[model samples]
Target chain A: MRVLLAAAVVVTLITADLHFNKLSTARSLLDAAATPLYWLADLPARLGDWSEAQVQTRASLLEENERLHRESLVLQGRSLQMASLQAENVRLRALLNSSALVRDDVLVAELVGVSPDPARHQLLLNKGASDEVFVGQPLIDADGLLGQVVQVSASTSRALLITDATHSVPVQVNRNGVRAIAEGTGALGTLEIHHVAATTDIAVGDLLVTSGLGGRFPVGYPVAVVSEVERDPGQPFARIAARPSAALDRSRHVLLVFIADAQPKE
Target chain B: MDDSGYGYPVVLLTFLFAAVLAILPLPQWLMWGRPEWVALVLIYWVIALPQRVGIATALLLGIGLDVLEGAVLGQNAFSLTVVALLALVLYQRVRVYGLAQQAAIVFVLVGINQLICQWVQNLQGVGARSALFLLPAVSSALLWPVVLHLLRGLRRYYQVS
Candidate 1:
């Protein structure tokens, strides 16, 4: 009995991954069932957001206002100094406008849930295919590139974060424009730059951003900041590490960069 | 299988709940440390009602997890099948043990389950895992007593055969 059961187990492993192979219709039903559950699972966070907004009472608001006023005064003083360098910054932005890029139309989506599986770092967003969210759309946080949409549902979608061990993006050093592929180091705050030559002019603290080589992400979102550089005389590649831009845990909201033609071309 | 109290319908409902739990958007920080809720619940069923759940059930859930996780289709199904086998092995001997002993046995099974997950991940060529993942294994196992208690209560209170 056990032998047959074990054989059946092997068969289950082989055939069970329904894999959307013949279950296309079933997936839609699954998504339909998931929509209300997404809202339910997100209730705590939504309530948190609501209560947070509610918790800032008049007294705290006045205190916050006072602090903002003081901070604004200091920033105003700094603005005069920045005005002198404003032209150069604008010129850089203009220069970056073409070869490099920045986001234009973005929809901020609340991250509703995440896969707890350590192997895959993916997110469930409140936005879905119904919201014009499509595959290959760049998901980013305020800090940097998060991941792109891999699956779409009517009410929710899945995003693979950059820190997910499975993900890789082509990146360029902001300082020298030296391009290399940055792979997830399988940690939330870290990435590994693959095959940077020992002779490469890379340095610690150099900024790394998407190079748009894969054309999966945008031209140049700040992806990471190089944190370490390990050079071995015998090894041709320098072991380099960078901090990922998106700290997916700290914030509930992120921007999904929506483009007219969002599909990535080979 | 659909009894008024406990049966296939309840199992199906659990799958729906597990699927929702499986796909909920997690924040970046907590993403890696997330627990396999579907796996946990399914393991409970396998341990509780072996007749209803076994390799085939685990495989189906694994496939669902695969589509939900967006990995190669069979990756989780394969590992889950392995877990189902573990549950079957433990099912016989586990009943003889005390609650704590049963929980401890479950802990070992969870460890093996996590090990299988790591192995599957390695095979998939995406292997930057932390030891923190074992946290869920421990956590899910530790919860076994409570899960069994609640589920047993349901089985008794609802009076399903």
Candidate 2:
């Protein structure tokens, strides 16, 4: 009798969660309560980082600082050119009667935990609703798109990586502007582009970038580089695969992008 | 056998510790073989103190796990309730069984838990492509004796019953 009651409750909860999403508030409350568990799980990694910082040699630190100084000098020089280029682009857009592009704001978030189940490519981040992180916000690393925020609590959020089996992104070929959808193949390194014509101009090594057609991700962010294109005379569509540009397996910190228009109105 | 005094906190702490171990980051290669720590702990409590830890306790812990993993709210709850029911039914016989026999029963229980979770995941279109999802069951079975001993030690130290 108790088992029957529990089963009924489980069925109702699942149906409600899947259909109406009415339990999001309850989920967030549970997430807020569970934040300390995530922190506890992350303690070992944090301790390792702390010990490494404490044990670093002075000479090695000096050498790393010198390298960063030189790299910053080079970056400063490039930024000066970028400023002038941005001004020129805005002027051109004004002349063409097109709206000027707004730079996206990004919040840096540290990874707190990852999905325990290997089959799910989800990340738990340290930023959440308190940081104005909303569901569907795009996440990126230094290299490319990483994932999107799926659930947010008071101080923590969960993101599903682009390499998750259920995730797909709209992308265009950088070389030819041909559009296609890149679907995750449940592997960290491979994404599949389905339904391309056998005669399409896509080639191996072509860069793929977000086209912003879906309006979830910003335009022109590097997504992947085409790795293979198999065209067979027997099949009407070609089989293509690309490797994700983001360091999906290695990045410790990621950025949550906040587009001005996408932000909820106060 | 209604020794409710001081038993609740010890059981709750064990479950909390199990939750931490469940999400602790592991190397990619090792993740597939990671044991189901929470399920093992739940099984231990249900068997050792069936009156205190039954289907209701299982349902609540399962919900907490679902929240922690960001899974559908009732996915773990349903699976764990089933595990608790099986453990409850078999507790009498399991109490007198040898360690090897107990471990074999645990394998079947955790395997069923994994199957139900995978079925729910498949409905959501994110299920694993191969039988690798069952790897945790094997690993959990292998770790059963260790978990059993450690939890038993803790239970004795705290005089849980």
Candidate 3:
């Protein structure tokens, strides 16, 4: 018997992605149907985590508590400064008669799971389409950029970390104002600034931030620092590498930022 | 040798169990090595009873996997259906193959399943990942003997008339 079932899949792939849309919609429904099971399965893992947390050393817990208290004080001071700055900016914008910008409504999500493959680094966020979160929305943790929602279901979504091999972002050097695109090199803890001319005034220690050149990522967030710059006098593009500011290995919770009325960055 | 009347319910129970395993959330670091538990159980049944199990079972289960894994909708379905076809082909003779040979064949089939998965990702317009993509294939195949044994027990437990 000719089991051309596999052939049908191949044909579907060749025919165009449109036919796959219906199948995807159907699978999405299945994904929704499966959410309760996902939550139930997560119970044991949550229990394991609770047990582990209960075993933290007393001294270490005290130290962490002290650290958090100190951090909270610093944050309180910063928030006061931020209030003053916001008032000043609003006064200036009002003087110029410019409309106030619409602030993004952020949905906080806890990291639930990660991509099963070690070769790739992506994360599953607790919020999903059901939470009004959508794909293409940028994710930001306390430190800085986490990633963006690439795929979202009703109960959860997946963020492709900027460190992931397939991810790319537009960036600028904070010092020189030089713009470049940073691409993920498929490793944890590293990214490459591609297409820098040899004559480019690139230097180690230059801070790279989201340039707002790409409408995807928000402007002025810290992305990476030029940790090493090797200009092979022989090659056209300089070999530039940097580290992401967000600790891709560590952050447990993040905010999915929806720019409520963000005009596409020019 | 047919238990569609009795064993089918056990198979459904296994399906639920596998789906639950897939959905179980863990801390970010530990979630990476999660096993393909559902695929293993489905493959076991298809091999054990060719007459009782068929293509639609694989497709539906693949949909469940797609939802749980959070891959593009049809990606798991595509890879899993491919697994079902191959497993069905080997169903009758797979039992007679000695332990070592069986283990090797299991590895190859699991590897093929992973490749089908990679292919599906490419179709979904994602980049190809490291060779570490094959890690689950080894883990799943290494798990085959145990998964098979456990299912046999479940079959007996639930199928008792």
Candidate 4:
């Protein structure tokens, strides 16, 4: 009788969670309550980081600082050009009467934990709704687009990586602006572009970027680079695969993008 | 059964430790081999004290795990309730068995737990493509004796009756 009661409760909870948004508040509250568990679980990694910092050689640190200083000099030179280019682009947009583009703001969040299940490509970030991190917010790393926030609690949020089996992003080829949807293939390094015509201009080595059609991700962020293209006379659509630009498995810090127009109106 | 409930705190602490281990980050290759820590801990408690730890305790722990994993609220709850029921029914016979035989039973129990979780994930269309999801069951079975000894020591130390 107790087993049946527990089973019934499980069925009801699963149904409510799957079919309705009513459980989201409860879920967030649970996440908030479990915050300390995540912190405790992350203790080993934090200790490792602390020990590494403590054990780093002075000469090596100096060498790294020198390299960063040189890199920053080059980046500063580029930013000067970017400032003029941005002003020129704004003027061009005004002449064309197109809506002005607003710069996206980002908040850096450290990875607190990873999804324990290997099948799920999700990340737990230190930022949450309290940090104004909301569901559907796009995440990026230094190299390219990473993922999007899927769940937010008080001080922690979960983001689904673009390489997750269920995730898909709208992208365009940088070479020609041809649009395609890049679907995650459940592998960290690979994404599949489905339903492309065999005659399409896509080829191996084409750069895929966000097209901004979905309104979920900001425009023109690097997503992936085509790695393979297979065409067969018998099949109507070509098979294409790309490598994700972001270091999905390696990045320790990710940026949550806040676009001016992408905020939830609620 | 101990009506004083003096052992409940110790039981809760063990579960909390298992929860911590369950979410500890592991390298990519080791992820599939990560043992089902919470399930093993729940099984231990159920076997140790059937009266104090049963389906209700399993259900609550499973919900906590679901929250920790950001899974659908009841996914682990369903699987763990079934595990608790099986453990409760078999604990009498299991108490007299050798460690090897107990480990075998644990393999079966954790395997069933993995299957239920996989089934739930499959319904949501995010299930693993390979049978590697069952690898945790094997790892959990291999670690059963160690966990059993350590937890037994802790239980005896606390005089958990």
Candidate 5:
């Protein structure tokens, strides 16, 4: 009888999680209790990182500093052009009477942990609710779009990668502005664009960027590049696949993009 | 030896360390073989001290694991509660078994945990892979003797109730 009661309680809990948001606060609190365990688990890797930094030779550090300086100078030069382009874009938007796009601020976060289950592609970030991170906050790397925040605790958050099978991003072809949705295939190396008309303008090698149609991600961030396109004469839709632009497998640091109006609904 | 207050805290610390091991990041290739450390440790406690570590304790720790893994809530809790109940029922027979025999039982328990998790995940629309998901149960059973011996040594050394 007691075993049956416990099973009932478990079923109740699962149903609550599926159908309502009532358990989120409780989950956050439980996650906070488990934070120290994750930190302890990460100790060996953190020690290795610390030792690697400490053992770096001064000459190597000087060489890295010089390289970084040159890279920063080039980036600054590009930023000068970007400033003028932004002003022009504002003017164009005003001429067309469309709302000017708001700039997104970013917060740098460290990868503290990862989801244990192999079926899910998620990374836990060091920054969480205390850092003002909320669910649906977009994450990016130096290269391109990465993913979005799915759950937040007090000092950590879980971000689901674009490679997760359940995740999809709205994207458009940079070549001809043909919009489609890129859906993750659960495998790290690919995402598929489904339901495209056989005659759609999409082709191999076209760059896919965020369309911002769903108001979830900022517009024009590179998402993927079309790797394969198959159009069958008898089929109504083309089968398309693309490679995600971000180094989803290798990036250690990620940026949380804070857009004013893209806050996910509670 | 006595029912002192130190007993509960020691158990908690052991479980805490197990939780840490369970979530530690591994290289991609080794992830499937990572043992379910929390489940193994919980099994140890339920078998060793069934009166103290019961269904409620398993449920609580399982929920903590669910929160830690970011899995659907109650998945681990359900599996663990069942495991604890089974351990409770079979504690007398399990106590008399040789190490190898006990490990076979551990295999079944961990396999049940994995099976329940896989079922819940499928219900939530996650795609199923092949039987590779059951790898943890095999790994956990292989490590059961080592975990049992180490934890037993600790219990004796510390004189935990």
Candidate 6:
């Protein structure tokens, strides 16, 4: 009788969670309780990072500093050009009577841990609701699009990666302005573009950028590059696969993009 | 029953340690084979002290794990409760077995636990990539003997009920 009762309760909880998402608050509270455990578990990695920092030779440090200075100079020059380009873009939009593009605000967040489950591609970020992070906020690394925030707790948030099997991003071909949806294939290296016409002109090496169609991701971030384009005669649509643009497996720091419409006004 | 007063903390502290290990991140290649540390610990407690640790304890710990891993609520709880109950029922027989034989039973127990979790995930349309989801069960079973010996030592050292 006790076993039966426990099973019934488990079934009820599962049904409620799957259909209604009734346990999100409970999950968050539980997350709060488990935060210290996460911190403790992260100690080894943190210690390794600390020791690595401690052991860096002065010559190597000086070289790194010089490289950074050189990189910053190049970035500064590009930003000056970007300012002029933005002014020109605004003038052109005004001439065409189109709305100006919304500027994106970004917050730097450190990757504290990753989801232990292999089936899910998620990263736990150190910043959360206290930092005003909301669901569906876009995350990016230094190079390109990463993913978006999915679950937010008090002090942490989970961002789904673009390579998760269930995740899809709207992208446009940088060369020809052709649009397609790149769906993750449960593997980090590949994304599939289904249902494109075989006659479509998308070619290998074509760069893909976010289309910003669903208003989920901001427009014009690099997403992926076409790697394979197969035209199957038996199928009406061609199958295309692409490699992600960002260093999805390497980067440790990510930026959360807060768009104008997504943030609540103070 | 003299040590019953100290039993709860022993159970909780071991669980806390297991909780940390269960969610510790592994490299991409090794992640599939990461042991189910929390389940192994829970089974150990259920078999060692069935009167003190039972289905309720497993349920709570399972919920804690679900939240830790961001899995669906009650998924681990359901699997863990079933495993705990099975361990409790077989405690006498399992307690008498040699460590190797006991590990075989643990392999089956954790395999069942993994299968239940996989079933729940599939039901929600979140299919695992392949049969590799059972890899953790194998790894957990392999770890059982060591974990059991260590925990037994800790239990004796601490004089836990």
Top candidate (DockQ): 4
Per-residue alpha-carbon lDDT of model 5 for B43-115, expressed as tens digits?
9988888878889998988888888888889989988898888899888899999999999999999999899
Instruction: Name the regions of candidate 6 deviating beyond 4 angstroms.
Output: A263-266
Candidates 2 and 5 compared: the better one by TM-score is 2
**Clashing residue pairs found in predicted model 3:** none
Local accuracy of candidate 2 as per-residue lDDT tens digits, A77-109: 889889889999999999999988889999999
Q: Which of the predicted structures, 5 or 6, would earn the higher DockQ when compared with the native?
A: 6
lDDT of 6 by residue, B1-161 (tens): 46535756877988999988987867789988999999999999888888888998888887888888878888999999999999999999999999889999999999999999999887766668789999988999899989998999988888777
lDDT by residue (A69-123, candidate 3, tens digit) is: 9999998987988877888888998999986544567778987766654545677
lDDT of 6 by residue, A183-259 (tens): 98778788899878999999999999999998899899999999999998999999899999998877788999998
Deviation of model 5 at B56, angstroms: 1.8
What is candidate 1's DockQ?
A: 0.39
The top-ranked prediction according to lDDT is 4
Model 2 residue runs over 4 Å out of place are B1-5
Clashes of each: 11, 0, 0, 0, 0, 0
Off by over 4 Å in 1: A1-32, A63-103, A259-266, B1-40, B67-72, B85-92, B128-132
Model 5 achieves a DockQ score of 0.68
Model number with the top TM-score = 4
lDDT of 5 by residue, A140-254 (tens): 9988899999889999988999988889999999998999999987777799999999999988999999999888999988999999999999999999999999998788899
Between the candidate structures 4 and 6, which one is better when assessed by lDDT?
4
lDDT of 3 by residue, B1-161 (tens): 44435546667887899777655654554544556777787788888766666577777677567666656555666667777888888877888887666667777877787788787676555545557667777778777778877887877777622
What DockQ does each listed candidate score?
0.39, 0.85, 0.36, 0.86, 0.68, 0.72
lDDT of 1 by residue, B1-161 (tens): 56333556676776777777666656555655555677777777777788778888877787667656556555667667777888877887777779888777767776776677666667566654457767767777777777777666765665534
DockQ ranking from best candidate downward: 4, 2, 6, 5, 1, 3
Ordering by lDDT: 4, 2, 5, 6, 3, 1
Question: What CA root-mean-square deviation does each model show from the true structure?
Answer: 4.9, 1.6, 3.9, 1.3, 2.2, 1.8
TM-score of each: 0.78, 0.96, 0.83, 0.97, 0.93, 0.96
True contacts kept of 1: 0.41
Residue A57 lDDT (model 5): 100
